[model samples]
Target: MTQTHTHTHTHESHPAIIKRLRRAGGHLNSTIDMVVQGRNCLDIAQQLQAVEKAIQQAKKALIQEHLDHCLEDLVGPLGAGQRKAMDEFREITRYL
Candidate 1:
């Protein structure tokens, strides 16, 4: 994708992204409270893990959405070689 890809305006911003992040923040706060309240170590670990997973989900959704919208728009008409590269690139992004 071109450098201008970041500037492309989609129909809506990352609403799901925001929601996941907010939920993660709430979990983090709860985790902190749990720590202060002498909760069981295993329970605290589980709460922290929940926070980590929520943040990770938000990150993955953001990357996939960017690829789906911005990259697809910028690479409007790909040639044979470019098409192969694009497809391979998409495959690699699955790691995100």
Candidate 2:
């Protein structure tokens, strides 16, 4: 007897996303440096907040791009399947 399996995957990758993530990484490294240098708590908190927001924005952009490029393309016209997939995506977004 023989068995076969298949897997399909698409990566959500964009240059802008990469740039934003790199910026966030740099900000995080700076935040660590600030901690080492004993910066003010408020200053550290503000930098951390900025880093968090940058990461959040990057995530938002990546998801939106996936929806636009992959999901929207896959679902195409306004049909039952399309509507169901869109609804499922909307429900999933509640976590964000």
Candidate 3:
């Protein structure tokens, strides 16, 4: 069975993050095309690596932004009981 967990941060992704993701998406598409065309293995690997790095960077930026803005605002005045849960969440995000 698959369980879904929900996050409370509903804010839109930062523009830079969006751009980064979109670029990564485009690169991913190009990588697919390259594979289909039987491009050199080394060239395909390089493109795939670029796509992977781009996506990783976008994810990192989004997570950082969430911690910077959403969590900062929410946690600032959280009650002691509430903060414990948020602190747990904060710790979890670090692994992402």
Question: RMSD per prediction, one decimal?
Answer: 4.1, 6.3, 4.9
List residue ranges in candidate 1 displaced over 4 A: 1-13
lDDT, candidate 2, 1-96, per-residue tens:
898548655555677888899999999999999999999999999999989988997898778777767776675666897778877886686468
What local distance difference test score does each model get? 0.84, 0.83, 0.82
Candidate 2: RMSD to truth: 6.3
Candidate number of the best lDDT: 1
TM-score, one value per model: 0.74, 0.67, 0.67
lDDT of 1 at 76: 91
lDDT of 3 by residue, 1-96 (tens): 998658543457677887999999999999999999999999999999999989998888788677757767864777788778767876687677
| Position 84, candidate 3: lDDT | 80
Off by over 4 Å in 2: 1-13, 80-95
Q: Please report how far candidate 2 places residue 6 from its true position, in Å.
A: 11
Candidate 2 residue pairs in clash (backbone atoms < 3 Å): none
Worst 10 residues of 2 by lDDT: 4-13
